[model samples]
Target: MSGVQTPSIDFDAFIFDLDGTLLDTADDLGGALNRVLADANVAPVAEHIYRPAASNGANALLEAGFGDKWPELEQLALRQQLLDYYAEDIAVHSKCFTGIEQLLIALEQNNIKWGIMTNKPGFLTEPLVQAIPSLSNAQAVVSGDTLSVAKPSPDPLLHTAEILEVDPSRCLYIGDAERDIQAAKAANMYSATALWGYIPSVDAALGWQADFNWHSPIDGFNHI
Candidate 1:
């Protein structure tokens, strides 16, 4: 049944995108965005509507709240307000996705190193990761602030592979965004798209061009 001894890859390391890929963090992010909208006396966005935008970061989330008003509104000020509010309640409703704990355990049992690589600033990413036991002890963490250039540049992913002491070719990277796929390809790493991550309802995962696509943590983890 093992048939032709299927070509297999022993991924030495796994790197993940923080927000939508690893954690269900929409609540805190959406919550903060709504607060900022309220301060502007605008109607708050429904949580379900903002969930997808949350994964894209503060700028996108803020734009969702601002809507047409975004053009005339000052993005920087609103983004700061959103960030400030988010900092106040970082991990309130955040938690690992279902099966992630099992995946992490499996990785550990197999002696595969796992880490985080996200565009979120280190200041915010560090505390958030620390608050979650499973996330805090990653083998390496390459945050947006860790380097001047961010993802889609491949620098962060390459940096992470170096820090983990694994060849880029031996690492598997999972993320929810298209940039994640681009970075992985550029770094010559395997790319797996986390289909369950917070992709906007208007977007399609087909365009990401990842090596493989997994709809849930179990599916993705098992694929590796």
Candidate 2:
């Protein structure tokens, strides 16, 4: 997973999970949670404390930040507030993982289609995708709300493949979360784990049984 191997990129299309797989959005997400916690007079959580939860979205971030002091009754409002603060400066600290744009450009150069399928809601996904100019080149962008179901449900991945006009069997799905591998398996696509993404632990990621395990976007680029 660390050293790049010879290229054997046969997939017709590549579908990626937004948060951790392609972009490192932990600081922006963790920063948003800290802002929310500050409003509640709670202490800020460090990146190490909440980084793993970045791929799980805002709810997990709030949980990591507030811990036992989490306000269950105001959860919904607090979630919205965290989102508002995040949207105000969505890509302020977010950027593609090393070699992501290079990999993307490689895919494009080879006439291979690529897209994003994230559990992030459309509202946040839209601006965040826009803020990162490289992402605008995606052939398809499917948010959690794009369909009734999201990852762990194959629907979103299938929809992304549909948009790219590629068969599910010909798509390579890469992500940082277990749900991503599960979705790819359910969708009949090849699955790869982004080891460099916001994974909780390497043991848990290896347990996901991905077809390929990439230690970094550079590994992915080499594959292409």
Model 1 CA lDDT for position 174: 90
Give the alpha carbon lDDT tens digit for every residue of 1-224 in model 2.
21123246588999999999999999999999999988888989898988999999788899899887676548889889999999888899999998899899999998889999999999999999999988889999999999998889999999999999999988989999999989998998888899999998998898888888888787766555
79: Cα error in model 1, Å? 0.9
lDDT of 1: 0.85
Every model's TM-score: 0.94, 0.94
Predicted structure 2: lDDT: 0.88
Query: How good is model 1 by TM-score?
Result: 0.94
Tell me how far the alpha carbon of residue 6 in candidate 1 is from the true structure, in angstroms, after superposition: 10
Give the range where candidate 2 is weakest over 10 consecutive residues by summed lDDT. 1-10
Tens digits of per-residue lDDT for model 1, 1-224:
11121244578999999998999999999999989999999999997778879778898898888888888988888888889999989999999998888888888888899999999998889889999998766999989989999998999999999999999988889999888888998988888878888875324765676776777888745545
Candidate of highest lDDT: 2
lDDT of each: 0.85, 0.88
Error of 2 at 127 (Å): 0.9
* Pairs in clash, predicted candidate 1: none
